[model samples]
Target: MTASPERQMELTLPMVPDIEIAAARAAGNLAREIGMASASIDEMAHAMIEACINAREHSGSQDRRIYVKITGTSLGEGNSRIDIWITDHGRGFNVTEARSRRQQLGAVHKRGWGLQIIEAHMDEVSITTSDDGTTIHMVKYGKNDD
Candidate 1:
């Protein structure tokens, strides 16, 4: 089978209420075009929303903007995958330390579950953070992927 060219979309959003919905909608549309299952598309949208909200609230970026990139790559035989990267230029925090603190806080807490939600929804998740900023990378496989 021949490989198809990757499809990509990028969005920059000012840190504002209800803006995350636009990002989620764009992600859902791309996932659908890539032949991702409806359920997976919904999950991806949810993850996207959470990621954006997390960045907006916690990133502390002076620019007050969120950057999102979505890439869809064909895996041949009707299979495909979508990768999403969410970035914020702000003071960063240690992921490990944050996770530990969240664990201590427990599920009883109503907030700070964005990371957990994103991880639960996406097939693969990774994070990079430094004093400069934080970027979250997430991927979800298409319906036909084994």
Candidate 2:
């Protein structure tokens, strides 16, 4: 409902810890609305939690704000590609550096697994970051889309 659920959606959430729950809820609803399978919906929620957590901890947003946006082609029996954008206005880190750090982490590492979980779940993932903030763009296909 952010933008008619047709072309795109934009939502602003008060930058706060524990906001991931809200995100997961919204994602699950959208997935169901598009007739996505339960398994995929769960995966999307998992990724959303990781990303939202990262945004909360890393995105140095003094005002404490997080943004979620959804966009898709259509929802039905055919196929659809859903795109979600999670952004925060905090100090940004280099994508390459983050990946390298993740690669260097031990299997039992306690932290720094947000992006890793995200990349593992989503069909496509890309990140763009700068001093202004960080934005993670994640894509997933519907039940029959992939």
Top candidate (TM-score):
1
Cα lDDT tens digits for candidate 1, 32-140: 7777778788888899999999899999999999999999877877777889999999998778765654544446656877888898899999999999999999998
Question: For each candidate, how many residue pairs have backbone atoms clashing (under 3 Å)?
Answer: 0, 3
Q: Write the per-residue lDDT of candidate 2 for residues 1-146, one digit (tens) a residue.
A: 33234556677888676789988888777766666777777888899899989988878887688899977655456565678999999989878766765545456666787888999899999998989998999988767424
Stretches of candidate 2 exceeding 4 Å from the true structure = 1-7, 75-77, 102-109, 144-146
Q: lDDT at 20 for candidate 1?
A: 92
lDDT of 2 at 81: 61
TM-score of each model, paired residue for residue: 0.88, 0.84
For model 2, where is the 10-residue window of minimal lDDT? 1-10
**Candidate lDDT values, in order:** 0.86, 0.79
Off by over 4 Å in 1: 1-5, 101-108, 144-146
State in Å the error of residue 63, model 2: 1.9
